[model samples]
Target: MVFLSYLFVLPVTLLVAEVALLTGATTLAGVSAVITFGLGLITVPIAAVAQGYHRAPDALSPTTAVVWHLTSQLWDVGDRIALEQRRCRLRSCMQRSDQPFALPRRAVFVFTADPADAHVRGNVTRSRARYLYRLDISDTYGQVFQRGIAVAIAGNVHATVSARRTLTATDVPTP
Candidate 1:
């Protein structure tokens, strides 16, 4: 009981002192006196009886409490703003497409309408086992002419190359 009283009473007294100091009361002898007395009554009995509160209440540190509250509120607002931006960008992209082609569900071999025409147009090349299709696309023509539709189809070709490559490297397995 003595241990409980000293632990509880001393810290409550200090907290009251600190609160009075922060609020700039003229003395510890007015309305501030009544407030701190009420706070002591509430805190002292609990600290004496509860196993958890054998010492001063460490749960209400001012700095950590303020930081956690501010961080949570800021994250909530930021996430909503990010979601709205993504929705707006998606809508804008959809509006720009002349006739948007639906993506294919499964992979399949794509053949040009005419192999001879593809070869003569210099758009198709054949090696030992595969044929490749190629096209040069820029942003203005790609969206305006619905070139994504043709590119999407050509993407299914066995070995398409759209750009020039000077050198290539890959990890080779050692026997």
Candidate 2:
């Protein structure tokens, strides 16, 4: 229902904006029209989510590029990322330290790309996610982020406030 509404609303809204743009609509006026539709004002996202379709980060993947950019920005701002369902936080992201060998601590997850994981778990397919790196976490709740490897079945990527690193600018960089 929400998706169908988006299909109808997004294009119609875009069409209006384009028409307005063609007519030399001012920026404020364009914003007003888009706001009038009530999707809420969508500014440039400071961070983005790719909904894991894989179980770990693929360095060669275009998705990795997106993650690289997004994660870099997040690191700059010192933010933690949530892996949707599992809601695990990615801190001190280390790439390719070890292969993920077991189900992540929070298989409280849903697969979006592979229907198999979804079928087996009865979760809505969102996409694949993987551990991009291997980092040790204090894990007070004892939930590790897929053992620091990405896995399949994550969706709705967004930045979070969980377990961020406590490094200051003067801290010695890890070797």
Best lDDT goes to which candidate? 2
Q: What range of 10 consecutive residues in model 2 has the weakest lDDT sum?
A: 43-52
Note the Cα lDDT for every prediction shown: 0.28, 0.33
Tens-place lDDT per residue, model 2, 10-120, is 777777777778888868457747564665322111111122123343322333322211112233234454434444344313122132232222332322122222232
Name the TM-score of candidate 2.
0.25
Q: What is the per-residue lDDT of model 1 for residues 1-175, given as tens digits with 9 covering 90 to 100? A: 5445656766766676677778875476355466656755555344334322111122222321111100011222122111121222121222112212332112111222222332322331222113222212111111111121121111111121342211111211112
Query: What's each prediction's TM-score?
Result: 0.17, 0.25
Q: Residue 135 of candidate 1: its Cα lDDT?
A: 19
Off by over 4 Å in 1: 29-175
